[model samples]
Target: MKDDIVLSVVLYSYLDRPIFDVMLNGSGIGGANSYGGNGMITGIRVPFGKQALTWRLDGPPGMARNGETVAMKNPINLAAEQIPADAHYLAVNIYPDNTVEFVFDKYIPDRTPRGDQIIDKSERHGE
Candidate 1:
């Protein structure tokens, strides 16, 4: 296996919903992968709130749907920002083999969530 490098950070949380359902800015390494069915990889769902998130770097997980689940096993604690947080956050890095390493701050009230910054990071996912 090659050295594990930072792939992307999935900054999102489900909160009361108990599930994360979107890939923040940073997603897909070595440039965007336009394959797998519709060829568009969309949101990713962690098992529950305040949990680590994972994804298949080998193949795209496809658009969000039922039964599609990922987990935040490494980071025991989730992170949030402010008392009334809009969304939780999880920093993740994807290894070459397709295994994702979630960088869990393990603290509630994580950094602010911004869609603009999200896509901006996505632009640099593989970079």
Candidate 2:
């Protein structure tokens, strides 16, 4: 079987509530924004160009499992070549029936910080 699948992971809160609401991490001022409902993590339109997946993550604290699950889809010809290095962990195997089993790993980066929030706050107060 050819390996072909893509997935991403994030530390989301209130994601497993079984509803459609999902809270996503946002930029500076608004720490997070709600996107989906109960039991929701994200809403992504799939079969998107590879360029659409270049994600930038900020320094995080630890690896957290997203209790909620969301899916994005793409309908492309399956080939061993379409797989990315990050998706290699998916124990790809072809079944005798010609169906492919793609067991993938969660794509996430270790949490890291660019700077000190306390210092930034202090600077603002002094100014």
Candidate 3:
């Protein structure tokens, strides 16, 4: 099986307010016919207080147009300021084929009770 790289980081708000700054490093190579790849991020959605947040990176649709080359050599430094800080979660998913996707979300605790709450055999086996 081909191994992929996935990195995740959680940041907390400094004060009671919902704000945060984040930075990440990433690199990618352009398509074989293209000169180099380009990196971009698209903010999916930022909700209200106690609400969830979501975002992702640009996909194939945003890539270079019809046989063009864009050279990119230096490491890509991604930074976001004043982003929602409520239970923030960020991750970089890199596939074996070099395709990358950035996922961001706000984690909310689940308070619902279900039958799964009861210990199952798989749980006992640490599966």
lDDT of each: 0.32, 0.27, 0.28
Best by lDDT: 1
True-structure RMSD for candidate 2: 15.8
RMSD of each: 14.2, 15.8, 18.4
Model 2: per-residue Cα lDDT over 41-121, one tens digit each: 233222322321111122234434233233223223434455565552322221112222233344433222211232344
Q: After superposing candidate 1, which stretches have Cα over 4 Å from the reference?
A: 1-49, 57-73, 81-91, 96-127
Candidates' TM-scores? 0.23, 0.18, 0.23
Instruction: Judging by TM-score, tell me the better candidate of 2 and 3.
Output: 3
**Per-residue lDDT of candidate 3, residues 52-113 (tens digit):** 22212222555433223222223333334323445354433222122333344564222112
How many clashes (backbone N, Cα, C below 3 Å) per candidate?
9, 14, 0
> Which of the predicted structures, 1 or 3, would earn the higher lDDT when compared with the native?
1
Which tens-of-lDDT digit does each residue in 1-127 have in candidate 1?
A: 3222222234332121222233432333121222111122323333323433343322334534433444434443322321123333334433322333444433432323442344346467832
Model 2, runs deviating above 4 Å: 1-40, 48-50, 53-104, 111-127
RMSD of 1: 14.2
- Give the Å error, residue 127, model 3: 26
